[model samples]
Target: MFAALAWSLHAADAELRRALVPTSRYTPSELREGLCAALLARSSARRRRVVLEVTLIAGVNDELQHAHQLADFIAPIERACFDPRRKSGRTGVLINLIPYNPTYNRLAEGETVESRNDMSTLGIPHYSFFERPSWERIDAFQDALRARGVWVSVRASRGDADASACGQLATNRKLAAT
Candidate 1:
């Protein structure tokens, strides 16, 4: 996604891409390797695009520091194709920050909604968690991203009234199970 902005359309995908982040599943080095591989994949004509998607759960990963860290991560890629003599303005990477939905809670065993647990259980041995981000937090985070020159956007809340959106699936299944 970052490198492809500078690549010709023929070398990239027509639609923007996506990738889940905070991949609690992998270590920092491993994450770096994954990003490098994606970049290499694009530059080498093996793939067209790669969009890094990170869900910002209100107080969890919505911190300004997270934005900075993300910016730092993609800075080098942004400069990779730059030419001082030419105005080769790059379109840059598209980062889609999705705020968590609370329709279905992924509480840990023995955990309850009143507990206010903000920790993530992803990639952990055996755990899951869920939370939602406030509109204010989302705005501020997007501003931070803009300051970093990163192309960032909040994934619009879709199908909220459908009762079948993300998180809600579990609830729907439970109701059916009953």
Candidate 2:
């Protein structure tokens, strides 16, 4: 119950049981709508606008979903635009980046090349957070991506306190041990 409060988008439809979750799930838009509708059909809510934590192009599953199936998949949403014309509703998609954490990725920059490319291919509005894109090239990051309204939130390691945010929780372990 408390977890639901943290997410801004919630559905009041009793048959739809979607609660706000920290993690994300990505599938065809119709599937996402159907899933949400099923959840709403069962849950109780005074608020219908709930943030759906969905992965646009993040994990292994994100890679497997077919882009062409979005419209039929999201039919439960009725009028949800693949690319929304306006931002009036409380309902929004918290699009998480894929390949999970992009930090130790010695492979290609999945978020930039693959995920972003795929979302664009699907015409879905998305937001990305880079693990460690070279600071000098942020201009390229901003220009190539943000200008399109696909926001990229970079991780800031401002110091020890900021270390945890960078996924370096072990930094605290040494201090606690001493």
Number of the top-ranking candidate, with lDDT as the measure: 1
Candidate 2's C-alpha runs over 4 A off are 1-34, 42-46, 52-130, 133-161, 166-168, 172-178
Number of the top TM-score candidate: 1
Cα RMSD (angstroms) for every candidate in the order listed: 8.7, 12.2
Whole-model Cα lDDT per candidate? 0.52, 0.31
In candidate 1 the C-alpha lDDT for residue 174 amounts to 46
Per-residue error (Å), model 1, residue 175 = 7.1
Residue 171 displacement (Å), model 2: 2.3
Worst 10 residues of 1 by lDDT: 9-18
Runs of candidate 1 with Cα error greater than 4 angstroms are 1-25, 41-48, 79-88, 106-129, 166-168, 172-178
Error of 1 at 132 (Å): 1.9
